[model samples]
Target: MVLNKIEQLLEKYENAETTLQEEQELKTYFSQDQIAPHLEVYRPLFAYYKASKHETFTKDIPLKTKNTNVYKWLTVAAVGVLMLGFYFNTSKHITTTDDDLGTIQDPELAYNEVVNTLELISKTLNKGTATVGYLQTYNQGIATVNYIHELEHTSNIIFKNNK
Candidate 1:
């Protein structure tokens, strides 16, 4: 009768359908010295479970952390020094004299200066326009290739044999 009960409990345990009380009964039966001969294979597994239940962790964990506050303050101090140096350096070179204004008193001289500047800008723009001509030629070549592909597709459609 006990062997039949143990077999039923073992089947329920294998299918994960046994309650905690049924599991305790299985553990108690396996702990005894007279476990059935055919059930000896599960003895070691249950023994391991029993032994593992009493095991405890004994190692200490480290709690030391790095000092990043000093590095953060150093970065802030370096940026402050760089900004002060840049302000002082640029202030020393920014003194504007009357000659720096380039103001022409004569109207004719100002008119000639304006004409010369415009001519220079026109020549630079003409150089850029010359380069754009090559792009126009490339666009024409691509259009010719696309027209050829369309003609080939139309010809294939007209000459295609239908059975």
Candidate 2:
């Protein structure tokens, strides 16, 4: 009767359905001497569990963290560089006079300048429109492909109906 119950518990244990109490019963059964011949294979497994249960870590673990001294020195060096750059930047004299600012006093020269600027803007717009002309050709090619697909679909329907 005990052997039958042990077999049933072993089946459940193999399927991972055994409870903690059922597992303990199996462990105790396997730990005994003079078990059935076929059941002798599981003895070493239970013995291993029993031996491992008494094992412990003997060495001390170190909890030391990494040093950030290099990172701190890098941050200090970066701040020093920024301070030196600011010192040099502020020392330079940058005077912005009217002529340097490109302010025109003569009306005829100003009108001519406006016409030249408009001409440059128009040329840039014409270049953009030339690229758009390629897009228009691409759209026509896509429309042609779509028409070919419609013809193929109609031919397939007509041939399928004739068959």
**Model 2 pairs whose backbones collide:** none
Candidate 2 ranges beyond 4 A from true positions? 68-163
What digit string (tens of lDDT, one per residue) describes model 2 on residues 1-163?
Answer: 9989988988898899999999999899988886888778778887899999999999988888679899999999999999999877766534444456577999999999999999999999999998888888899999999999999999999999999
* Candidate that scores best on TM-score: 2
Point to the candidate with the largest lDDT. Answer: 1
Clashing pairs in 1: none
User: lDDT of each prediction vs. the true structure?
Assistant: 0.92, 0.89
Can you write out model 1's per-residue Cα lDDT over 1-163, one digit (the tens) per residue?
9999999999999999999999999988999999999999888877888999999998987787788899999999999999999999888668766466778989999999999999999999999999888998899999999999999998888888541
Displacement of residue 6 (Cα, Å) in model 2 is 1.1
* Model 1 poorest ten-residue lDDT run: 92-101
